[model samples]
Structure formats: structure tokens, C-alpha cells
Target: MTVSSGSPLAPKVVRGAFVRLDEIGIGVVPQVIAFQYNPETLTRKLKPYEQPADKQGTPQDPAARAAPYDPEEEMDVAIAFDAMDDLAEPDRHPQTVISGVADRISALEMLMYPPATPSLLTSAVGALAGALGIGGGADPVPTTTEVPIVLFVWGPGRIVPVKITTFSVEEQAFNSALYPIRAKVTVGIRVLTADYFTSKLTEKGARLTAAESIAATAYRAAVEQKKVLAAVGVASTVESVLATLPF
Candidate 1:
């Protein structure tokens, strides 16, 4: 999206956002949690997967190739929210006057929780039966709680699904109703790789359920896009390097 500036020569400004999908692949794009103001700084770390030290010397199979795995990637960013700006324009942001930044904060936090399921009442009933010494007539249906897939969008080049590993919120001010008026939030996220859907994810012994399988498919699609992007730069990069050579 392009924003009109006083000078036509001004660069385009597109805000970053965290878009929540209905499920994963083929799911509807339902909700968007946009950044009010982009974070000034982002912290990122990558640790490539390598053979263990003990296994390095023990490898004798010449035909076996190196194992492929995605690097462990971590990202941290601080988001600031204030309700004063919205409160100044009450007509457009009437909800802000009532809840301050509470609504926005809730939206971000909800990404970590699974969507409500219809089995909630059934589960409650089973618990009550157990307490009264009455057995449930039949095996209860299992309920799965899967967090919604989220795409962290920083322009078009970097759009990836990530899992929230850490979250911290600091409320600097609150209104009379105890709603936070000004707050700062810090979130630590890890990118989910495509291998996850194929049972190739190597971090833990964890296995994906049917719901997460959908995300794996979408993750693969994103990985393919990244590959194409990298390939496009190869020729130009090689030419630039050759032109700068001393010989």
C-alpha cells in the first residue's frame, strides 16, 4: 500500500502486520493484527544444524550425504501501544475510549491460544460425571487445541509463519477502569519450517496433529518462494563479483 506524501519523490511506506489465518493452507485470511508503529529494531539469531562432535569422526559411509535441516531461527521485537491517539478521535475509535489499548493487546495474546471448540461443554460434563462417581457411557471424543497459524509480514520479501516462544507485556499507565492506556510488549518468535509437515522436523520428538499438517503445507510454499527469490539474484551476484576481481 502506498501512502501519499507532500513530495512525489518520497519513498513508499508500508506498515508491517501479523496476519492470522483461519487454519493454514487453503484457509481463509480472517484477522489482521497490524502494527500501530513499526518496531525500531529487530533482533534475529540463526544456529545452523551440524553433525554432533562425537558423530563427526565415526562417519564411515562415503555414499551417505550430509543431512539437510533448517537452522534454528529466533527473532525478538518490542511493540509499543498507546490509546491516547485513538482517544483523541473518539468517533472513529469509540472502543479505545472504553478499553484503552486492551483490545489490541488481547488480539495479539489470542494468537497464542487455540480457538474455542464445540466440545467444551462435553468435556465439562465428563469431569462432572467423574466427580459424582458416574462413568461416562462411552469413550469421549478427544479435543485438540492448536494455535492459529500467523504470518509475520515485513514487506513482501519476508512473510513467514512463526510460533510465539515468549511474550512479555509492560503497562506503563492505566485508566480508571484498569485498562492499560500505554504499554510495551516484547515477543520472541521462532519460524516454522516446511520439514515440519513431512515428519522431518528435528528439534524435538514432537509430532504434528492434523491441524498442524496444514501449516506445514503452507510453510513449504513459502520456502519455495524464498528459493525462487534467491535464484533470481544468482546471475547478477556472480557478474558483480567478477567485475570487482583483481585479475
Candidate 2:
């Protein structure tokens, strides 16, 4: 969550790459949900209450008290990265490693699991994307080799930070399931680029833009598939089934 730059090059634009990925994933899922539930229904379902009366029986304005935390109605998503130390001498560029890992993770998400609900998927993607860039001019291009690790979660659930103990390429293949139930899906990617190549590519800006575009596209595709599955489930509810039953 925190990025420190002791030197100019050390703090590359790529630092925001993971953050953008997270935002894109988080942000998109919500729109899918809203399309299904609609804003009016969501507001009616989650309307805040006025303050309750005090123990003394005096009517206390609801606004006076802190708002209650409703886990069922909230969405939580996060993005993070750890220092890359597992790469061999020839594969040490952090930016490339991270980008590659991110792409792989996005591909897995697009191809594998289905989301529990369209709303949940939309919220997760929307938040993920927003965490990248929304209120700005052109999106910032990443410069560093920092690999982005993204976690997308839905529902009113507890947020737990994932701790990285060791860095191993083989371990990365199965890292998605390491987190407990709170996170619906977890992704960990490693970027590795040779120092010379990274330096050469960083000078052009196009490479970083391409990587971002690809990551975003992959993320959107994955979430869209999740949304489709959710919609199918909703359409096939118990009521619908009973109505179709030949009694």
C-alpha cells in the first residue's frame, strides 16, 4: 500500500500499475450489479436510519450517532506488492516480471471462477479500476518493475492483509487460493525484466501503456464472464423453477 522512492529511478511509474489493476477490477464488478439491481432498489434496500432515542427515552436524531457498518452492503478490494527477490541474475527486472505476472493473473480470472453475483463482481472491478486512476487527465504510466498483486472481494466481509513470506516462481501458480474466504479471488504476479532491457523500454512510454491496456482488457473480460454467470443464476431462481414445474 505504501511506495517509497529513495532515488528517482527507484520510484518508477509502474508503481501505480498494480493500483490501477486493482481499481479496474474493483470498479467494473459494481456496474454489473447496479445494472441488475438498479440504483433505486439499492438505495431502498440500504437506506441509512435516523438516530435512535437515548436510554433516557429522549428522541436522539439518528444523524447524531455514528452510522452502522453493514457488511452485506459494502465491498472491499485491495492491491499490494512485495519486493522481488526470487529472480535469477538474467531475469531481475521487476517491472517486466510484475507485468507478466499481472497478465497471467488476469487471464486466470477471465478463464476460471464465476462470481457469486453481478453486483459483487461489478463492485469488485469498479473499485479495482478506481484504485488505478479515475479523476485525472491521461492515466499515469508505470516505470518501475514492481509487480502488481491484486485481491478482489465482495460482500460485507472482513479485510485481511496478505503477507508474503518467500518469493518462488513455482509458488506463484497456486497463490490465488492462499487467502481465506474474505477474498473471493486473489492474484499475485511477478515482473522480471533485465536491467538493460527495462532501461531501454522505460525510455519509450509505449511499452508501459500497452501493458496497462492489456491488463485492463484482461481484467474486464474476466469480470464480465463472472457477471454473466451471476445473471444466469439469478434468472433461474426457485420461483422461476416452480412456475415452470408441470404440477
Candidate 3:
């Protein structure tokens, strides 16, 4: 997801999706109003690993050094929607109001369960058939599988796979039947850290999804690294030297 100089300069439209192990598709696509995220870092000032030298043969400006740090990146998104409240065709999809809300909740619930697999049902049917003396072979027992992680893509320069950490739903209105018609949902997601990719989620080609998150992470790292380098005068020094070079 590198941004090339030739790429478009406009802000990319934000879109989100869920990536599954057995299937490649999104569970729900919400119209998000605002998306917020920040990288939180913890740094400890400790004795310098290698002290700088001066003409006096003593450590120069040696007191404490900030350790190399990686910030924890997390995102919070807000989505507001009104289902049956449309003016043009208020009844267009009367069922949509509640149905849409249901879909959103369903998508969140999926994070806690494994993707729908036929093996579980197949095994049960096979067992029943064998018990009934019908001609059938034993089906292989199914192992537990993990639910898919969601990917939020704001175009190529911003594609990150994330896990839903927390979410809240607030209903503003409801129909006569008490079904929600207007609601705002706030979802908090943590970017799947590189450590996670290298660990548990690596099985079954999940590495591809890990790569996507890594790319998003690289973008943040570049920004933070740039700031650090600029503060240390490295960036300006390099730029000045490069400017004097002949083509």
C-alpha cells in the first residue's frame, strides 16, 4: 500500500470489510461519519546504551535515553443511520430500518463465533445415519476455527485488518412495534498488531491478511519516524546535502 508520487492526491473514500478464512466477503458495510485513531506509546527514560564522547573523554549530555518505542494503534469509528425515516419514500424499505440494525449487530456477533462450516452438521448427520444402520461412513470430526477479522480500507494507502475490541449501540427512535428505526453505533477496533500476525493467526494463509495490516502499520511508522528524525536534525541535514547534489 505504498503511496507513489504519481497517485491521486484526493482523500481516499473510507470503506470497511470483514475477511474470513473460508470465504472472501464482508458481513456488513456501514456508512461511517467519522473515523478516529491514534497511536499510544510508552517510553521509559533509562541510562544510555552507548554514551556519546566529547574532547574531554566524558559522556556528552549523558543523562537518560528514550528507548526505541512502537505505539499501539487503535481506531474508533462512528456510524449513524436512519432506516424508515426517509422522506422521499419513507416506506421504501420499512423492514430495512430494523433489518439494517440487525445486520450490524450480526456482524459484530460474528467476531465471537467461527465462520459457518458444513463439517459440523455433516458429522452429526453421518453419526445418525450410522446409528440407524444406513449405509454411511464416519465423517471427520471438525476442529474449532476462529472467526474472521475485519479490514478497514480507505484505499490503497490505508488498508488495515483489525479486531473489534468494543462497540456500543444507541437507538434514537423506534417503530410502533418497538423495533429500532434510527441508531448510532460507535465501534472501537485495534489494528491487528504485527506480533499477532507472527503468532496465533498465521495458520491457513491468514498471513495475507496480516500483510494488509502491516502495510497500514508501516504508514504510521513512517510518519512517527519522520517526526523523530526531524527533531534530531537528521531529516534537515539529509535534505540540505541532497539539495546540493548535481543531477
Query: Which candidate has the top score in TM-score?
Result: 1
Candidate 3 segments whose C-alpha is farther than 4 A from its true place: 1-70, 85-100, 116-145, 200-247
Go through the candidates in order and give the C-alpha RMSD of each one to the true structure.
8.0, 20.7, 11.5
Residue-wise C-alpha lDDT for candidate 3, range 164-198, written one tens digit per residue: 67778888877666766667766676665455555
**Residue 118 miss distance in model 3 (angstroms):** 4.5
Count of clashes, each model: 0, 47, 0
Each prediction's whole-model lDDT (CA): 0.74, 0.34, 0.51
- Candidate 2, residues 1-247: lDDT per residue as tens digits? 2234557667522121222222233221111100111111111112344666789999886456565532122221223223233224326655434442443334334322233233344454455556766534232232333333332222212111111222222323322334111112232332221221234455755353333444434444544665788898987896878889999
TM-score of 1: 0.69
Clashes of 1: 0
In angstroms, the error of model 2 at 118 is 41
**lDDT score, residue 206, model 2?**
35
Candidate structures ordered by lDDT, highest first:
1, 3, 2
In model 1, what are the clashing residue pairs, if there are any?
none
Total backbone clashes of candidate 2, pairs 3 or more residues apart or in separate chains: 47
Per-residue lDDT tens digits for candidate 1, residues 11-114, read: 76777777776532222434788887789999989877666545556745445456588887789979999998888898998788889999999999988987
Q: What shift in Å separates residue 110 of candidate 1 from its native position after superposition?
A: 1.2
